[model samples]
Target: MSGAGSVGNDVDIDIGALFASLRRNWRFILVGALALAALVLLFCLLSTPEYRAETRVLIETRESIFTRPNGETAADRPVLDQEGVKSQVEVLTSADLLKKVGAKLDLAATDEFGKPSLLSRGLIALGLKRDPSQIAGDENMLREMREHLQVYNVPDSRVIVVQFSSEDPALAAKASNAIADEYITLQRAAKLQSNDDATDWLEPEIADLSKRVKESEAKVANYRASSDLLVGQNDSTLATQQLSEISSELSRVRANRAASEAKAASIRRALETGAPLDTLPDVVSSGLMQRLRERQIQLNTDIADLSTSLLDGHPRIKALRSQLADLNQQVRGEGRKILKSFENEASVARLRETELTRELNGMKAQAARAGGKAVELRALEREAAAQRELLQTYLTRYREAASRTDHNYLPVDARVFSRADTPAEPYFPKTLPIVGATFVAGLLLLSIFVLLRELFSGRAMRPIDGVAQAPANEIQMPAADETAQPVPGRAIAEERAAAGTEYPARPPASAETIQQIYDSYTTIGDDVPENPHSVHAIASRLIETGISRGLVVSPEGDDGSAASVHLARELADRKLRSILIDMTGTGAISRTMLDGKTVAGITDLLASEKQFTDVIHSDHYSDAHVMPLGLADPERAMRAIDRLPIIFDALEAAYDFVIVECGPSNAESVKRLTSATTQIILSVVDPDDNAVALSALDLDENGFEDVIILTGAESSTPTPPSGDENPNPRPAL
Candidate 1:
């Protein structure tokens, strides 16, 4: 039982099953394994032995002469990562490398890997030999080398191993050593070839570079010579300096001219306003002019005094005014002379400023032309600079490459760390492994084959699926013993009565066993009917037989109500409308329904007081509609049940199935519904329930198309009453 439940656990493995299978079919495994091992031994003995030779190679990570710390080479070499190491490994096993080894050894001409077998040798002696060269040539030799060659990295080391196999031990060693030596020699040769190639290419490139350098430099010189910029080695031209010097001088000259012009204008303003000649600094600074101002003041004082003492034209006043006039005239003449000199200086300054302006403009024009020429000069210089830099770079590279070609000291990154030796023993024809593997594989296959054969033969017993076969007497048929099902279309009536098709006469199982059976029953019953034919098997039988009405009848037990509910639910789950008519007036469905309460039901329809839709209530257990005997008087419903013919006819026409829950009290209605229905499932509480068994047989005799018994448990076979006494065997309900 534990083993049976483990199948549902899904995580547990059944080791007991494996051991049991092995124990049962030990002979098959032994015989099959022995036979296979003998065959493997025979093959090993006949096959030719192969010797393997190995060579070890170490990849050097030493610093290069030119690339070592602070050496001339600019860019640092990239370090090999895991992928890079793998790439190097690929190079060792490449087809081209194998092809090179094959060509050097001339294995194609020798038919190295195509040695004639015994049969072929005999055929060849009889002048039936094929062309050896045509049979095995360059392509075959290359392929053989590729297939036989194996290169792999030594774990946790910077070394790789190359292995090869051959019939001849010495040949194997020779081939492996040759491959290693060729790989190293190939690397050195490749580098030397690259150096020589670089030298050849660089010679022409350097010449072109040198020519470009000279041409660019010459352009700079020519541009300098053609233009008048006269640019110096200091990056400044003479015209620029001259422009600077002239601009300074012009500024000084203009300042001087402006000073002279300002003085002249001030003197002219003094003369126009007729201001005191002493107002002029030059006039005031004159010794005679200062004396004349004093004399003029003295004369004006006298004139004022005389005019106060005498008449308007007094001699004294006239004399004093004349003196003042003379002094004023001298001062004016001094001021005029000073102003004239200033005018001449201003005129000279104006002429000099004009000359400087013309000279400055000429210098600016020349400087503008120099600026344009300077741009060309700078361009030429840049070209020269770039050419020189490129030439220097190529020269440096070419010199290094030339030195390498001259001194042929090319070192390979990898070398032979260890040379392969000739193998004394054959590496192949491993007799023990071959035989052991054959035996194990053969045993496994034979075990599976035997188990499958026994299973299909209906003899294999697995704890997971229960005892494969029950005894023929315990079950009803030999075939039914293999699977818990009746033989197709051949159910034994006795088995049907004991299992389900017929009602039980007695309780054969204990309470727990009956509960287990009910649990399994309800388990399958819960599935919504995605497959209608399976869930509605009973209803389907009736429909196939062109009948739509069915009855679940129990005369001795009350289990008919439950059976009827199950049948109607099954039919409803299949998307078929089913009405379970409880004509027994038990209200059993009402009591069992989660929220159900009985009310006046089917009797109302018979009395014409209610329609079928109004009185019908749906059952919580299933989608099936229930027409319970309602709150109406029980006597009325019992009497109105005589109208069941019309009611049953209407239900049959309206629904896919109508399951009538019948009791002994409603036996007449049962008979009428049964006659209308093509199917009748006789349900009993226990297999030993005597009354329903007798009623089931009577119903069958009375022409019910199907009288299926649903027994509650297994029971003993009971004797029926003798012949004519039981001719009409409808037990009193």
Candidate 2:
């Protein structure tokens, strides 16, 4: 967990760390800022300087003229008009005025470029290429010219200021004056043009309209004359009178004709009825056919009444019938007589018509006389039309002449009020402002770069800077077991006394059997120990570093393990001839550690198949030789430690140190081997416990001795200790 925590805390960079980084790399920041400042300064030096000149212009109102119509005084009018000021300001920047300025100043010639002057060539060589086309009359020059002349209204006043910036002060002033001059000239020209255009258009229009009026009048007169239209007031009354007279004559003729026919019918009826003509009523007054019808009705009534009471042969009935027949005959005769009377009446009507026709002819003659006057009037109308045409022509010409005369004295508004003056300066490259602005820009860029760099770097400092430290504790080693039975000597007795247990003369048959007897002790199991010694001599020296009581060794530790190999070499260099016993059934130790120098090892010695002297390699060092652990069967390796006293007695007489590398400490064979050794030396990495080295030192169980904590090497963090006031503090442990 400590190891995990250390890894988690590794990459954090706190404020202190950041400050340290800054302190260490301060040069980079200083260089960057200085370089920026230098660049800004250099740009300022290279940039062209510009100067400004300002002038004020007041918009002239009607009141400002100081003279007015009717001789009014200037004090009588308002001092300033805002609308007029705005209008005049707009005119100052108008395209028309600018174009006029362009023309009047011969700007076209100044805008073009010739072959490069020596100074221009030098400037070009310096990477400042000035194009001839850019200098030509275009938007750039116009813009530059405009920039030199700034026109603005003065606050709370009718007056406006015209400010300009240029390389030459006098030129700036002149350009400003020129803008005002050109604006006035443009105003005058525009007014004159407008007035002239109006006059020109009106001239031809007046002449043409006069001609059209004359032609219309002539057409009206000629129409009146040819149609003989009596346009007098009484003509309508006369026509009405003539119509009434003709109607009256026709009515009278019809009445007379009716009267005559009636008279003729009555006479004929009297004759047909056998009445005397003298006895007939005046049918002329009554209407001839009407009277006959009345008589017929009376006869018919008598016939009908008589037939109802009398037979056909009766005299009264016969008489009545005769009367009805006479009545019918009278009616027929009256009808024929009326028709004849109509013919005679028609002849009489023709005679009256002839007389009326004569009268009508006389009236027509009078009408013709009036119509002849109308014709004369038409001739007069034609003469009037010709005169109107002539009048219109003359009027049109007169109007044209009048308009031309008015144009000759064009309005005073067209008068030129001002003229342009020569400019004295060019306007561009404002020096102080450009340089100051560059400085500000450079500062901003530097700030942005710094901010971004700080944002992206993920760094934090350690959390335990002011925290208290924890105390260290000693590590313990595991106890011996059945496979690691004791050797016959005082060292074994000492191990037994230190552990407060009785010495077992013979090893247990199985690891479980030994575990049951020493239940209080957590013995090392059969696995390669983390930091095991290959030689007992090295183990004894490690024990001298502290104290180790009950020692456990494993057979697998003799070889194949880096720790075991290192221990064996260390022992040999310390002038000790160590015999490494491989009790694990594999001859890996002898092959790897000894480089296969001897074929016979512990297995051969234990089996008595080869003498111990023949298997052991003598004189590895001046004072010691080594008996390497060789290949063994599992059961045989387990039992190999039972003969440890014999091997040790042989080696003790010849050498001062006898180191044995045993199988894994947890194995039964290791217990047998450890019971023979002097003491145990437990090697542990400072920050590891899962490895076999720390497991063997079961500090919670069997305990340990001479535990040397070997920390994996690392560069120490630089931190000062508290108190003591020492400027140069000792390094942390």
* lDDT score for candidate 2 against the true structure: 0.52
lDDT (tens digit, per residue) of candidate 2 on 366-404: 667656666566566576676666655555545644554
Candidate 2 lDDT at 95 equals 65
Q: Give the TM-score of candidate 2.
A: 0.29
**On residues 458-492, what C-alpha lDDT tens digit does candidate 1 reach at each position?**
44444444435676778863232354222111333
> How much lDDT does each candidate structure score?
0.70, 0.52
Clashes of 2: 42
TM-score (C-alpha, index-matched) for candidate 1: 0.44
- TM-scores for every candidate against the unseen true structure: 0.44, 0.29
The lDDT leader among the candidates is: 1
